[model samples]
Target: MKNITFCDQYGQLGGGQQVLLELVKAALENRFTVQVLIPEGPCADKLETLGVEVRRISNCALTQGKKSVLDVMRFAMYNLSVFFNNFSVLRSADLIYVNGNRLLPVAFFAQRILGKEAACHIHLNHGKLEKKLFRIFLRQRRTSAIVVPSAFIQRELVHFDTAFDSPKVRIVENGLDARFTSTAFEDRFSSRPLRHVGIVGRVSPEKGQDVLPALARRFPDMDFHVMGDAAFSSADFYATLRRDSPANVHFHGWVEDLPQKVREIGLQICLVPSRCPESTPGHSFEAAPLVPMQMAALSCLVMVRRLGALEDIAKSLQLISFDSDEELIPMIESLRVQPAGEPLALCENSHKLAVSRYSHNSFHENLKGLLRALIPV
Candidate 1:
């Protein structure tokens, strides 16, 4: 078997981790021997059931919140342990595939020692330290190539770093299971008012969780739902959001059954407030924008605050884009009162787009081909 050892930045379950799970499933179905390097958490149990060998690296540096000298030393010690402990797998694997940029340094280190082929799938577009880390990947030779989920990342890579002028990078758009796109949502709720509007994902400052409460205050009658939990986020921010939240705004923390929850709540519009999580203030990149796509695939109307990077995928979908809070309020109000005829038509159109564009079958084929090319038998 051509063994491919996969790695994730965190084994804690999240959107990216879920995608990693899907990739794990694909790798196995393709008949490759698969292994995973991750911090021990709930995700390990899931990966284990899938029959892949799981290697746990204790207390990863990427998840460390406070930056201090001791923290740096601790991170170094753990990484050194990872390099030595997982040496057998690291050195012998046909390919080392890491999930995100945080693990690129570790991948680079393993590649240098073993001279094995590797791929780093970067899900985010821009970070100040990205160029420095990516430059090291190119010069070091072991990291092999970069795989990105969107054209926004490919563009950002070229614009920000000189190393990308070579053929060391490829763009693969994120895909969803066909079940979501094919789901038949009978318009039973269409007759009801478009009362429930919300955002979905981790509750963090950059993710716009705190902004939801104030947005709820603007319209007392309409209920605004914040559907997520605060993990790997600022405690104070989560606390602040709850403190000021009014009677109408509800925070349902960490929803697992999203489709069921959407049905129960009668969610009419989805507000996706995202930015380039890695970029500086006022800077955003073209990311794949996972949640909005999911909602659209499920035949829900969406409104987004995005520009160049996500514009291409979202352009064909019937999503309202807003540049500022000023624009969002009026739009939300209009959608709340307006007849459902237009939004319903847009939702149906988006379902068709979602089916053609983001199929899991295509994602797996692209990934298998990428891995095969990297590790030639």
Candidate 2:
């Protein structure tokens, strides 16, 4: 049996972590001896429950530009510890799959020693330094491929490193769960005042969810709901937002049954307001978001920041896209005044397009192909 080990830096259930679950699930289904190295948290528990061997590695939270000598030594020592801890399992595996850009260095070190087949599955945006490092690692020994979920990200990476060719990079779009595919489209306009607009995902500064309160204050008629909590970071960000949130705005931490929760909360419009790359390319929020696209597939008149990853999908589905808070308010006003039929039709069309674009079968096939390329059958 081919032993494939997947490493995820974070332990919580976020978009990237969710994709890792799907990847692990696919490997199990294909009869591969799958192992996962992750921070001991909910994700590891879930993997353990599913009978996958999970090795817990303590997470070294990003030391955002702490340049002091002592701080740098601590960061380096922490990484070295993580590397040493996982080195044995990593060496034994036929293939090591690294998830996210930051964790690349860890796997790179292992590959250097073992020269084992390795590939990276990227789900978030990388900056100049990360891009430079990724290129450096990509060209190193035992590095086989780079899997990205969108053409936009592929372009961003290749453009970031012009000398690096595209042949090794694999484009694997995130797929919609089959359970959510058949669900009916939402009729957002039916509400007399057009209530219950929502933003869902792991709450973070980058996600731009704090803007929900200001939005709720602007449109008193709308009951704006923020339906996710801080995953990696502290709850302080969320606690502050909740304490200060206007009456119309609500914060519901991590919904279990997402589709049912969206329906129960009467969430008519879904918002993707992440603000990392300010204007040009879409941020990681657009990097195959699970919540927003599922809402789109369910026909919720999904609105995305025109600059984010979801913009291309929104445009393809002919759904609405907004750049700023100024642009968003007017669109919300239009939903309040416009007849329900127009948006309902658009939601249905978007759902149809999304179902075709992201499907379980395709994602499974793509993941299998990526793995096979590393360790041939």
Top candidate by TM-score? 2
Write model 2 residue lDDT over 47-111, tens digit each, in one string.
89879999998876654332357754665776678778877788788888888865676677777
Q: What is the TM-score of each candidate against the true structure?
A: 0.91, 0.92
Candidate 2, superposed: residue stretches over 4 Å from native:
64-75, 186-188, 191-193, 277-285
Query: CA RMSD for every model?
Result: 2.5, 2.5
1-377 per-residue lDDT for model 1 (tens digits): 78888878676766677778877887776788998998887677789999899998775654323256776676667667777888888887888888876666567677777777788877766565666677677666566777777777777778887677667787767877544656674462366876788888877766766667677889888888888877656667788888889988888988767888888888777887765444255556446667877787777787787665557666856567877666777787777776777777877777777766776678767766776677665
Question: Which candidate should be chosen as best, given lDDT against the real structure?
Answer: 2
- Model 1: clashing residue pairs? 286-309
Which pairs clash in model 2?
A: 282-308
Per candidate, the number of residue pairs that clash is 1, 1
The TM-score of predicted model 1 comes to 0.91
lDDT of each: 0.73, 0.76
